[model samples]
Structure formats: C-alpha cells, structure tokens
Target: MSTAPPRRAPLFRRVAAALAVLTLPVAGLVAVAGPAEAAASATATYTKVSDWGTGFEGKWTVKNTGTTTLNSWAVEWDYPAGTAVTSAWDATVTSSGTHWTGKNVGWNGTLAPGATISFGFNGTGSGAPSGCKVNGGSCDGGTTPTDNPPSAPGTPTASGVTDTSLTLNWAAATDDKGIKNYDVFRGGAKIATVTGTSYADSGLTKGTTYSYTVVARDTIDQTGPASGALSVTTTGGTNPTDNPPSAPGTPTGSGITETAITVSWAAATDDKGVKNYDLYRGGAKIATVTGTSYTDTGLTKATPYQYHVVARDTADQTGAASAQATLTTAGVTDPPPGGAVKLGYFTNWGVYGRNYHVKNLVTSGSAAKITHINYAFGNVQGGACTIGDAYADYDKAYTADQSVDGVADTWDQPLRGNFNQLRKLKKQYPNIKILWSFGGWTWSGGFGQAAANPTAFANSCYNLVEDPRWADVFDGIDLDWEYPNACGLSCDTSGAASFKNLMQAVRAKFGANNLVTAAISADGSNGGKLDLADYAGAAPYTDFYNVMTYDFFGAWDAKGPTAPHSPLTSYSGIPIAGFNSEAAITKLKGKGIPGSKLNLGIGFYGRGWTGVTQATPGGTATGPAAGTYEQGIEDYKVLKNTCPSTGTIAGTAYAKCGSNWWSYDTPATIASKMTWTKQQGLRGAFFWEFSGDTTNGELANAIHTGLQ
Candidate 1:
C-alpha cells in the first residue's frame, strides 16, 4: 500500500554473496546419503516459476531435498550485473550490490524433504546473469537486458478463406544491464522489432506457405539461440469449387397444420468425397441415410414439422446444412403462449465455459429479468472435412459435465459441463430458460452451409442440443449466425430467405413452446446489411431477435479517439459504423421487426482506450488501453479498481488513471438504459454476460429496479 519504492542494496556486491552460499549441507546428509559421488543428496524443486516482468522481484516456489525435516534454511543468488536488490519477502535477505543474502527468521515448521515452499522479492536488474539455481538446479538466468534481438517470424500451418493470414508467435527475451528494444525478422530479413511476442503475417499469398525463426539480443550485444523454425500456409484464395461442403442445415415451419410438406435441397458436391448424411429431429441426430435421398418418417397427423441433415466425410468434416425444409406432421392443436426466450452469454473461443456461470451473472432483480441462458460455442474440427467453421475450431476437451473445465477439444460435447450448472440454475429459478447458441464471430463461417439445408442444420443442432445424455438440460435453440442472407464473417450465397428457411425448420421440430431466436447484425453503416437479411421475415418464426449492439468500435480500427463500446446515440465525429445501440433499434424497427420482439444489448463491461489525455468519451486517445481480453477493453471487476473514472462518464462514476480508461455501466447508467428500453418499447434489455457486477448485486439491482 505504500507509495514509496522499497529501498535495497548495490547490484554487483549482492550477487556475489548470494550465489556463494546458495546451497547448504545438513548434518544428516553427510551420514548415509545415497551416492556419495552425486553433487548432493537430492535436488530441491521449484514448480511455480513466474517472471513478473523481470528482476529478482519475481516469485519462486521451493521444495525441500534433504532427508531430515528442514527447521531452517537460507537461499541466495547473484543477479545479472545491472540488477540491484529492492525488496525481499518470506524471509530476510541482506543485499550488497549485485549479490544478495537470505535466511529463515520466523516460525520453523517441519519441511519434509519433499515438501515445497514459496518466497519472492522485488529487485532491479541490468546485465543477464550467467547462472540461476534453486536448490542447485539451473533455472532461467536473471536478465538485465541492454539491447533486444529481433524475434523469429513465419506463417500459420494452414490457411483458408476465413483464416487467410498466418500468425507468428515468438518467445520474449530480455537483456541484462539495460534493455534498448527488440527486433523481429522474417526469413533472415528484419520485418519488425515489436515489444511483444505475437505478430500477424498479413498480405500473405493465399495457399502459399512460409517458414520463419527468431533470436533475442541484449544491450551488451549478447545473442540468444534463434527460435526453432515454424511454418504456416495462408488460406487459399476464395475457391467455392475447391472448398468443402457448407455447414449442416436447420429445420423450420413447426406450427402449421399440414399432413406433409416437400423436402428438397441443393445437392452437396465436395472437392472430396461425401460419405453420408445424418438426420435430426425432436432434438435427436440420427444417421438416416447413406446417400443424398432421405424420406423423413413419423409425421404427426396434420401438424407442422421441421428437419435437417448433415453431410459427413471420411475425415468427418460435416458439410453445411441444406436449406432448412419444413413439413407438416399430423395431429396437433392449441399452440403455447408466446415462444420461449434463449438467454445466456456469448464468449470467445478457446476460453472455457465454466468461465460463464451464475456467479458471473445477475438474476436477482432487473438483471435477473433474463428468462434464458445461452452458451456461445462448441467445436467443429477443421481440415479437408470440416464441420461448421466455428464448431471446427472450438475447444473439444470441454466435456458436457466438466464444470470449470479449461482444456481444449476436437468435437463439442452435447452439454458443456456448464450446461448442467445451467440446468441446475433453471431448477432453482424455474422461470428462466436455456439455449445453445452456435455460430458466432468465428463459428459464423458455417452458416453458409446451414443456409443450404436449414432442415439438416436444425436437425444436427437439435441432436446436439437435446442429446438424451443431458435430457431436459436446455429449453430451446438460438441461432447466432453473424449475418443471415447477408455477409458477416464471410458471405452466404443461399439468398435472403436462407435464414427464414433455417429458423422455420427449427421451429417445426421444436414445436410451439420451444424458444427460437437470432442475433441480427448491427452494421447500420450502409443500407442496413442486417435489415437486408430479412430478420422481419424470420420474426414470424422466431420468439425474439437479439440485436448485438456492442463491438462497434474495436481495436480492429487502429485509428484514435477511443469511444464508448455501447453508446446510446451517435455523437459528432463518431465513425460511420453503426457504433450506437439506437441505430440498430431504429434500423430494425424500420425493417418491421416488432418492438416487442427485439431485445437491446447492454454491455456488462466497458470498452476503453489508453494514452488519452482527455477525460471525456470522444476525447482524443493517444494510444490503445490494456484489457483482459482485448488490449483496449477492461472487464468490470478490473475497471472497478484501475479505472474508477469509468463510473463518472455521463454522470457515471467511472474513472481512469494513467492510460487505462474503461466504459462500464454502473447502477445509474443501467437505470438510464432500462428507462430507454421502455421508452423505445423494446422487448427487454440484455447484457453481454452475467459476470462483471459487484458481489452484492449493485449493477443487477439497478437494472431490475430500473426496469420496474
């Protein structure tokens, strides 16, 4: 808590003493220790080795090595020449220039030979130290860098239309004595000398592969090994004929009273082989046919129905869905009230789902106004035979029941372990519902395929969403195709009604009471590409439309004046994108999307910019800000402390210190938004997620209270 920097000793002197007596011999060790020739009886282990930037200040974990329980001990080490000791912890350490001394001073507990301990200190470094050891094992050397060498560069292992450029990742190196900067090289030629480890190898020739490597140098001109060579191939230029089949189809037309309806599709031909088809209905995916022809059975006696299928390959990359086809089943009457609502969080890929939880969301009052929870993704592994784009790149290790699971996966499990938690939450809060949202920013690539055969896509989704293994876990489905008939992550050629066809099939299969919804694009910059998608056409079949109004101005636009993430109205000089929520609403309303069926998006967290000297929203930003996910955005919890200035924008209490600025919605801002949602006659207001609120429910409480 103290503002003053802790004091310490000279660099060179401290290093000498510390390294000199780092190791000690116990009385028992001299007695029957195994292998007299060995350097010591046993070596101590350090597991949690982390570098907080650099210097002796970093923390280290230590393990006991000797047979006797350690009642006391000492640890010492010399830092690189330019480094100096600033502070010490977990024990007392005396410093002398480059050398440092530490010894146990407090309580003495039995440190069983194999037991571990942790300690840390704060120090400054200059030159790179030759050797760093813990219990005598050489760890990464202490660095006091002077000059930095360029990092290796290269491309990706594979490329495609969706992923055209290869991204190069490199290891970061620091110099001792004093670091100047870093340089990055591509194919032996300097490309860029960045301060970080990641670089996007853009403007690459599609399908052309490239290899790269990197090395780091310090101020003293000491060079490290050139990183191992890595290779990447750019996604070949757009080749419809050569590309694999599209995403599976979704079903439509569930409420009509008809005995039967025609089912047809645009024959799916792939550059590779088309193995067979998998049909889905009633939330179950069944392998219905081996060839293209499939006659759906078990129709109700005069009830509307829907169906979808997935084309598979030897590698199992399921092609896009055929246009969703709707049929009438016999014997059904009396439709339920309005359709159900699919509520939940939409998160990034690679991150875990347990990261989304009730604890992360609010449901107590206005915030709890949500009737459903939707999880954004499940993987569809890519290759020659790729499922939907989003599904392919998803984390497969996130099994349906591994709550808090944080691993990768090849295929999506029916129910993310988080779904079970959601299932339980529904039981506790029966008024709420749950849905599976597929195809987001990354997953949208598959929607084109889904548009081809809406019925088949719907069926595939039904099977996964309603997998009996987790029966009754979800209430319905939510289609988050970035854009329907229009362009989003990529282009969809199936025409405008492609979305209508898919939703219709899903509606038929889900019956009258199930939930069906879609997140319409908010790109109102031009002729309303979202409106052109004919959301109104799908409204008749969907329960509600989620208007994604956030992410208008992002790090993607390198230009300045970092603005609010979700602005209510467009201010002067605002970039020409649909950066405000109001623009999306007005556009949707103009397109005839009923106000009662439109849900406005509210960001739980705030987007921000750094290097801005100004204090207002439209103020010129000098550079980008640091974020938990994106560099310029900050989560609410983090913003609460680092950028309290965020609370006072527009009478909001947010603030910013240094270059960190945030745009979080406080209880008051939430109240204003709720009032606006009512004035606009919007169906409701939705937050990006349930997380980012205070523990006592301040933000959520405001929303609930304001909504009333």
Candidate 2:
C-alpha cells in the first residue's frame, strides 16, 4: 500500500481552518487604572460563562444610557493579586499590576445613546473581578439599562427513572436577547448550566424525592425568575436479601467459522433491569456486553470451545451461569482448483536501507505461509508501464550472505538484484506465485494518461512482464492504481468508467489462467472515493480486490485530537462515522461485489502524534510524532517495546507514557479482527511490506494462526 496524508471530514476541515486563525496569548498581563474622574454615565455587567480547574471564561456587557453619544469607550476592572487575563475577543486588553483595561475594537468603538456592546475573555484565575469602571467614570449606578430579563422556563418532565439516575427534559425558553443557557437546580443548589433542553442526573440517593427548578439566562447576563418546582421519587435501593437475575436461558451458538462463533441467549428476568451479560470461554471470562449476543473470535481451527452466559442487574448482582454450550470450529476449505490466495506485497526498495532481502521471508517463515507475492512497484511513464528503479529491480549485486541461496553474484551476470533473488525463492517454494505490481501512490500520476489509451498501456505491460531476460520470474500482473476518478497523491478527472475499461484490456492481454488483480480504495464515506469510480464494473475482470482498509486516521494532520489509525467499529467519539473496516466491507457488498472476492488489508506499522499531555485518545497534540523514516509513523516492532499498550478502545490498543501517546493493534486485537473477517466471509487478509515486522516475524505468525 502507498502512504498519503490523512483525510479530514468536510465539516471538520472548516472547523480546523477556523481554529488556525484564532490564536491567543498564553500568559496574562497586569495593568492599573486611574482613579474615577467623572460622574457615572454608563453601566457594565460581568458574567462567568464556564470555569475549569485552572482556567475560566467570562463575558462583559457595556451599555450607554446617557443622552450623549460617546465616540470611544473603555472598561476597567481590578483583579486579585495572582489573577490576570490571558486572551480577549472582540476587544483589545492591557493590564498593569492588578488593574485591567478593555478597549473597544475597530468595529465596536463608537456607542450610541441606547446601544450596548459585549466582549469576552479567557483568564487564569477563579475569582471574579471587582471595582469596575467605564470611560474613567464610576459604573456602579448612574444609569439603568433598558434590557429586559427573559421569561421563566416551563416546567420539566422526568423519565427513565432508576434507583440512582433520571433524565429531565423541558421546552425551550424564548427571550428577546436570545437565551444562552439554562441553569438546572436540585434541592435549591445549582447543579449544571447547559445549552440543550435535556440533562441526565446520576448518582442520586435511592428511594429519595428530589425537587428541581430551571432559570433561563440571556446573552447580556439578564436572568429570569425560576420555574415552578417538580419532584421525582427514585426506585428503591438494593437490599442485602435481593435475589440475582434468573439464569440465562440455555445459550445457543451459530455462524461458526474456522476461528469464531456467535453466541446468544434469551433475556433473563430480574427485580431490577438487567445491566449486562458476561460471556465465558473454557471457564474463563472473555467478554462483557449489554446486548444479548456476542461473537467470540480468534480460536484455533477444528477446536472445541465451551461457552456460558451470566446476567447481572443494576445492583451489581450476577446470577448462576447457564449450562455450557460446546462447539468445534470447522477447518478452512481450499478453493476448488486454484487454492485460496494469500498474497502480500514485497517492495523493491526494501533491499536498500531497510536491509530486508528475499532471504528474510525464508528465514522468518513468511514465505511458506503466503501463496503469492507482489513485487511493488513498477511505474507508469508516458502512458506505459516501466521499471521504477533499474538498479533495485535487476542490477544491484548481492553478496553470498545477502543472496537467497548463499551464492555471490558476478559483475557480468545479466540479472543480479531482487529480481534474481525472487526467482531463487520461487524455485525453493514452487507453489508461491509472483506478480509484478505497477502504479503506486507516487507513480499513479500517469494513470489518467494510460486510461486514455488502455490497449497501448496493456501492450506495454504485457511485453515488459514477459521480457525474455525475466520471463520465468513472473506469473502475471497486478494494478495498484491509487485511484481512477478520485483524488490520491494527485487528482484524476477521467470518467467513472475509465477504470473498468483499463482492467478489461489487461485481462484480455494476460489471458484467464494467469492471475490479474487490483488494489482499490475502501473509503466508505458518502461521496467518497468508492462513489467516484465504477468498481463493480471492474471486479469481473480481476481475480479479486484488495480492500485497503487501514490508515483511516493518522498524524499527517499535524495538530490533532489523536485517534486510532484503523478502528474496526464506531466508538463514542470517533472523528468520522463511516471510516471503519466494517463500513467499507458493507459498502462493497452493497455495491454487488461478492464477499469472497474481497481481501482485507492491514498495516504493519503504527501512526501517532507528539506533545500529547493526556493519556486518553482525544487529547490535543502539537504535531506529528518523531520516527526513524518519517514523523508520526513507526514500525510495530519498535512501538511494541517503546510505547507499550495500556488499554484497548474501538477494537484497537492505545498507550500513553510521559508526554507521548500512541495507538496500534496487538496480537489479541488482530485475533478479534480475524474473527470478524471470517464472519464477513472475506477471502483473507494481507499486509504491507514485510520489513516492518520483528526478525522473528511475530505479526506474521499472528496473521497466519488467526486466519487458520
């Protein structure tokens, strides 16, 4: 697979652009104000918006009531000794010692007789300021503003009542100045201020009656009277003698595959509602979920597994485990005549600085496990396929130790590089087929030209792959077109059917017996790459499609709220809704492509960010993290020891150590994903270049064992 910058959602792109222009100061300054010099002519009011542990946001409204039209105005306040303003919006602020002055900006410098202007600021203190002044005059009481308070909010209704939690919803409040927020009160104490009409209250005492009220506040700090009170009684609390939920009905298993089983049970009755169910495998707890069904994956082929379910209620009480159900997974079935295709890419450049040669595959045991190898990547030049690097492909000399068969290359040899080593490996493993892949991310720029005259392009590729010098080294060809009608490293404007036409020409030239495959985009977002081309029309001409499913998110975005690179499911705070492995598979299946013709793609490396302070996935980062080959990326072999996984989320593992945070898949997560692949009925899974894995090929072992 080729690497590209991370793509952003359309809505998030606009937000990110806006944030780039909203820079503010990090340190606060202090300024002192002169003593009051004139009689009070205007009034100013201050309101606190929100307050975190170390910072606070505040707003101020300055109103003119006197008949005189003021040409300019400024507001001053005295802060505590250690407090200071950090940033101000819609106004220019300066400070001296404990005194702060806020001057009007260009747009709101002049004030009419009855006009008011509002400005806000972020500060580094908890306490509100005092000794306020406007235009160097006392602002306490000379003029009364004409703004009216909003009307009281309507009564609230409560539902989903539990022993310790309930939800409250109310009608929206209306105001001339626009309602900004509503303050929720419980037992005469302010509980929360929110912009929405509904709120969930949790952690309440059981069997207790609670009184609630709400008050509407407008943008100018005008608050209306509180609404009428309403009371709700919670359900009774748990008792020492309370009985547990009944044993779940006998569990049943279905959708059994070589490595997975789906188990479900009938709902169990309880004094309180059932909170969740625990699933056990071989007498060990494997998973806990709120639903009645769960898929147990990553098991051995033809292995017998025992499963049981136990239901629990809101009181943390679990019932007796149901009778165990046993199932033996079926063995993998081979294709009728041509065997399942377990293909992986072998980059020509891996023989350079990476120091990975064809010999590594033999030593690491990956060659015996895979069925086919793709030599990537040849390039497309002048509307024809050509060699990307002549030296790497056929001219570089390898020593006896570097060669696959322990034979040194002679300077006069016609073929001497990776092309020759691959030929030697194929001789040892006769079943392993090799295909020459062309048009990677960087070289795909010429595809638009090739699509213009596909017959000529196919002729060029056919003659090159079947050249007499290396005719015995290759079986067929594979097209790694980054995209056809959508954007990748560059943009393509050919019609939607251009890709299908090109694939047809290649199949016609290569014949049916020789394998012809293509790697296509798996973007499932609405109007994404999948919709830009006619993939279904091209599927019939190719043996199978490699669905590139990983790299959904990464640090190519520089500053980001970090997220997993390849999430299998949608979590609570996922950045994009449709950018997951499941969504892509469902989309292709919906597009009339059979599940058995698709092969899932996985990344052998991990992506991450730097300058992260929080351990969770959503924390803000400064930029891309440091790496050996590139920033924001590292091999799984290095990350497995550098930043070990601390927890799992969204079907992936994440780790946070000191100021660095990273996310990657572990052996256990890969096992779970393999189960999902079998459930989806996909042909198999493939990864990128082989050099990223450990010397022992730990990740390769996991993929081989999980697929079995």
Candidate 3:
C-alpha cells in the first residue's frame, strides 16, 4: 500500500474549542470613568492586546456591577475592509461582512453579581476593533463595584488514571476580576497552580488513595474556598499503605555516545516487592522499567544532563531519588547534505480523486519547510520509462485559482498539468529539488523486464526524464520498484544483482550533476526481502534510499490480529518479528549502508481494521475498516478525529472508536521518531504523501522542528 496511489483519499482535520468577549485594560489607552460617578450597572470593554502588523489578538471583558445576576453577554465589533477574524475560542464567533460577534459558550455564560467574564479572538490585518458593543450597550463598564473574592471552583473530575499519573479537569470559578489561576491541593496541601481548567499530575504511588481539590485566585490575588474533594486510587501495587522500596544505588554510566546514555544500578529492595524503577531527567519522568538498566537515546551532543532514579514498591509508593549524575555527550553527528532532507511525495493521481493539487504544498505551508519533492509514478512500461498519466503530468489544463502561481494553463501552453505547476513551484522555492519517481506497486511488474537490460532501461529513463519540454520540472529520477527480486503486487525474479546493475547504469547515464534515489522494501526479517537484492551495492548509485518503513502490517492479513503498520520500535506481542522501523534501519546499517544515504519513510496516513474488540494491540478484527477512498486505509487527518488515540505502543499511537481500531503517527509520535532518527544519525525523514497532514502541515512541521 505504501507504494501505490489507490489508498490515498481526501480528508481534513480541525483544531477546535474557544469565544469570550474579553476586554483588555483601558487604563492607559483612555481616561477611565471615575468610581465617584458611575454610569451603567454592567459593562463590556474591548482591547487589542498585541498586534504583529499582519494579525492581532482582541479581547472583551464583561462585568456585572449591579445586585442582579447576568445570564449571558455578547461582544460585537467591526473592522476595516482588510481585517477579519481568523479563529476564536471559549465562545462561538461569527461574522457579517466586516462585522464580528462573539458569544460565550454554554459552560462560562453565567456571571454572578460583582463577577466578570471575557472572550477573545485572533484576527488578520492591523485594524483595531471599533464600534464595540456589549449586549446592545456601550462596551465601557463605567461602574466600579466593591471587589469580592471568587466563588469556589467546580469539583475536580479525574480521568486517564495510571499507576504513576492521572489527569484532573474542573469547571472555571466566577470572580469579580478575571480569574488568574487555580491552585490544586492534595489532602489539603497545595501541589501545583495552573491557569487552565485541567492538570496532569504524575509521579504518584499505585494502589494509593488521594483526595484532590481546586481553589481559584482572582487577578487581585484573593483566593476562593476549596472545591469539594474527589477521591482517586491509582491502579497497580499490592497495597497502597505498604512502605516504599529503598532507593536504588547511584547510576553507573557506560556505553556513552553522542546521542545515547546507558546507565545501570543495583536494584533496590522493598518490604513488599519492587515493581518498577522510575527514571527522571530533572522533574520529568523519562522512562519506567522493571529492569535495573536503561539507555536513553536522542540526546544532544556536547551537552550535560542530570539523571536520577527512584524505586517504586508493589504498592506503587516511590522511595527517595538517588543521587544525580551529570554526563556530557561527546560530539555531534554530521548532518546530511543540505541539512536534514525533509522530502514528501506528491502523487499525480491525487489531483484526480483527492483534489490535492501542487498548490496545497504552498497553502498548507509545507513547501517552505521541505527540501525536496518526489513527483511519483512516472511509469516503467515495456522496458522503458514513460509518463504515468500524460494528462496529469503535462496535458491537463489548470485554472488560475488552482495554479501555484495564480496563472491559468492555456490549451496552447507549451507545458501544462502537474509538470507546469511543479515548474512554477520550483520558481517560487528555488531551493527545493524535484525528482521524477518511476515504478510503483502497479508499475513495478515492468521493472523485471527493464532489469533484463539495465543499460537499456537506464537509457530509456534518462531520455524520458530529460525530455526538454519538462526536463526543468525534474532535477533527477527516482526508482520505486517495490522489490527488485521479491513480491509486491506481483513477484520479481531479476536476481540480486539486477537492482545494483540498473542503479549503476542510471547513475552513469545521469552522471554527477543529477540526483538519483529509490524507494526499497523494509522487510527486515532474516532472509527477508532486503536480502533478495544487492541494496548495499546499489547504495552508491543513489543520492539516498527511501526505506518504505510502513505497511509492514495492515488489513492485507484480513480477519485477524491487529498491529501498528508503522511502529518505530518493537513491542511485546508485535504480530511479526522485524516488521518495524528499528529492524529495517538496523538491517540496512548492518548491510554497510551509511546513515546519510538513508531517509526514513513515514506514512502520513494510517491503516486500520473494523470489528475490533479492544483499543489495545493484538486484538482480533473482522475485516478492514471503512475509509473515505478505500477500505482499511485512511489519511491521518481523518483518523485523528474519527478515532482519537487511546494509547501508544513501541513509539506509535493507536485508537479504538466503536468497532474500529486504528494506528497512526501523531505530531508527538513523529517528534519521537525524528529524535530516534537523530540518535541513529539517519539522513532525515520523508513522508509518503502530502495530503494526510493537517491544514497547517502539523506532522511535517514536527519533523522540521524536531530535527533542530
């Protein structure tokens, strides 16, 4: 599936929640209405907090000054012709032309006498909010009522409980002035203070009972009464009342490297029994394991880190932390040519079904972050490289709106379709290199015949890719033969040396000026697909190899055990051995391939199954899940909302919603993978295609930022 275009379909994701008519302080901006002469019983005020010339955040605060309660309030304002609201939270925001309105959401609507509420929004253009009104009245709240302490916050509700951590959520409290923050208490003792309604508490004992309460504090620092207590008991540990295990000995460092730190220590003793050891970097828990040894990877070179360990008993109670040890990494790995290569595939067929055109790369903000683009499936038919879709490649006309440069493609134009658009994209981002990829799952069968005469095949590809009409559209050629001497949609028996010969000939034909790459199988099992060809020998001929690390498991198995299709590491009950990114990378590295010549493949989409019994892995499923474009396959954009992640394993996230179970990489998981890529000194990362990411290129941005 990773090698084909059939699975990709149209999908989108939304980042939701927010409108308060929040107002900023009018103190310095204008003369305040003195408290000696009050006007209205209640009022709202608008303030433009910060402006970046291009956009600004506006807020409106509504206050109740009278003895009566205010049920609801709405803040309305207008902007100039070029200004508009982009998005809002804490309320519903709508607009009529240049006029904008915000109303409080269900939970934060009511305001007690002498209490206040607020809403805010992000807007485009530099124009400030004007003609502001609150509930059909002037936004200025002239009256200044006597200040009173805020009411107690709603009782805290706990969820996502684990042996070491739990999540707490509560409703906001009412205050005369805006609420500044809430102090979280455990058994009447203050633990942490935060401004948000939720907090995730960690480093707790398992099987132990705890009581939590929240106290609200207003802007003037007046604290409210504590909310009612909510009792919680973490799962695990034999007895909560048992004494904690003794602290482990100071860690002994060994096997030190630039990107990894391996530490071991004597095990700690417990009265009941030792459960797990908690590893900490500063105050954050990095890992938990029952063993006495741990190796932390993805560390920066020439940097010092302080680490300590705590022992937890069967009751989940932890002992005092061991003495910290500071270790500095040795040296940094050399980055690949042109830094980390952030490449993504762009399929010709996408413009046909998914409506994902080349312009999406620019609009989604992906083009600015990426280093390369692989225009896929140029075709390998009749032992000669040919255009996959002539219309999509150079014949299809594009309208001005759909064009990358906002220029229409005419019938008389010399070049059209994706090729012309790519040319325009290159002109816009002159730094990005474009490679024409030939042979996919459907066209891979032709590679066998093409491999029969490597030189002839190389010659055919060179002539096609360098065709003057569209040669400037591509800087190089890429071979995605699926498997040189193994099976994909079909089987190939061109021998192990066939791939090496073809690649060498292609390099010879293209010479030193052009780039050459290939997408290879990632079956890392002993004597698996990787061994069927001379991948190591062919390594020199390629600018880099795209290890198709996904699709190791999917609905192809049908009626069966569910597994993460793109797990970065091996986990317990992994359905198959060596079917993961770790195994593939290790295997390739063991084959003498340099990490700089390897680009880890990431699937922007997800593979899932329906009729699943559990949210966790290793569960039985009836069949492939229903997807927008194809069964069993869905884009990350849709899966993120359709089935929110329930848990994670082996460095990837999985979710189960209703009867369907899905596995996909989130921005967080992608960051983790990018860290691993750095630890392994890999060249960088490339995703399967562009359409699966969010509108802002969330996943792609994760890679770009994580590598730094």
Q: lDDT tens digits, residues 274-352, model 1? A: 7677765322354456655455543434333335677776545567665544454445332223432224463432133
TM-score of candidate 1 versus the correct structure, residues matched by position: 0.48
Quality of model 3 by C-alpha lDDT: 0.77
Over 4 Å off in model 1, which ranges? 1-343, 346-369, 379-416, 485-487, 646-655
* Per-residue lDDT over 531-593 for candidate 2, one digit per residue giving the tens place of the 0 to 100 score: 778887898898888887777877645556788877787788888777778777766754556
Clashing residue pairs found in predicted model 2: 30-95, 30-96, 30-97, 31-95, 31-96, 31-99, 32-96
- Candidate structures ordered by lDDT, highest first: 3, 2, 1
Candidate closer to the true structure by lDDT (higher is better), 2 or 3:
3
Best by lDDT: 3
Candidate 1's error at 402, in angstroms?
A: 11
Which candidate order results from sorting by TM-score in descending order?
Answer: 3, 2, 1
Model 3: lDDT of residue 310: 97
Question: What C-alpha root-mean-square deviation, in Å, does candidate 1 show against the real structure?
Answer: 18.5
Model 2 residue 262 distance off true place after TM-score fit, in angstroms: 27
User: Model 3: runs farther than 4 Å from truth?
Assistant: 1-332
Give the TM-score of each candidate.
Answer: 0.48, 0.55, 0.55
How far out, in Å, is residue 146 in model 2? 55
- Tell me the number of clashing residue pairs for each predicted model: 133, 7, 18
lDDT of predicted model 1: 0.52
Evaluation by lDDT, superior candidate among 1 and 3: 3
